[model samples]
Target: MRGTAAADRQSRPGRRALVAADLSMLRGPVSGVVVLPNRLVWAPAPAGRFDLDDPFDRLRVYEIVLREAVHEAELRRWLNGAVLVEVWPHLYLPRGVRQAWEAIHPQLAVVPAR
Candidate 1:
């Protein structure tokens, strides 16, 4: 997706805000969820066979994994009804670092992952 189409896709009115508090309210262990203006649908990621050692590297890997999962047209089609929940602590960097990251990538926002 690019230019007008990309903008249109992102600008769609169904977009919803998922705050940190909402994540805490979830009952069970959830990897993530698909979000809409008024609803949240949980969809967990599969567990890996091994654990990651480095924290920074882990976050980068998670971002890449999410991008890969969400980039394809078929996956996007599957995601049509909701927006992906970006888990905090993992996806979120430290406070000062996060501010700097946002300075470079304005579209990025951090929300609590409970």
Candidate 2:
């Protein structure tokens, strides 16, 4: 019965890594300078705020949130849908994190032209 249950789960579609509940929940600022709380983004290095207008800053924010965020609210607070979609192809996320997000949002897989 345990084997059968495992097989059933595997057969189901849309199964993915345990990341955010959904990417659509991301409703953060699209353009602006924002400072993330230490609880969400903290390191041994000096404090550095992320400027959404800058690609590098945006990418860094996404990377940290995707990897270290412990709750969905954290993602929702710092990730905007428009910005996330635009930066999705460029973000260097872990395999599971990337797979989880891409599974729900296949459009993210489409890399934009440089």
RMSD of each: 12.5, 7.7
Residue 108 in model 2: shift from native, Å? Answer: 1.3
Query: Whole-model Cα lDDT per candidate?
Result: 0.30, 0.65
How many steric clashes between backbone atoms does each model show?
Answer: 0, 0
Residue 52 CA displacement from its true place in model 1, Å: 1.3
What tens digits encode model 2's per-residue C-alpha lDDT throughout 26-63? 78887788777777566533454888788888888888
lDDT by residue (71-101, candidate 1, tens digit) is 2332233221112244333563333433432
* Model 2 stretches astray by more than 4 angstroms: 1-18, 44-46
Error of 1 at 54 (Å): 1.5
Against the correct fold, how does model 1 do in TM-score?
0.24
Worst window of 10 by summed lDDT in candidate 2: 1-10
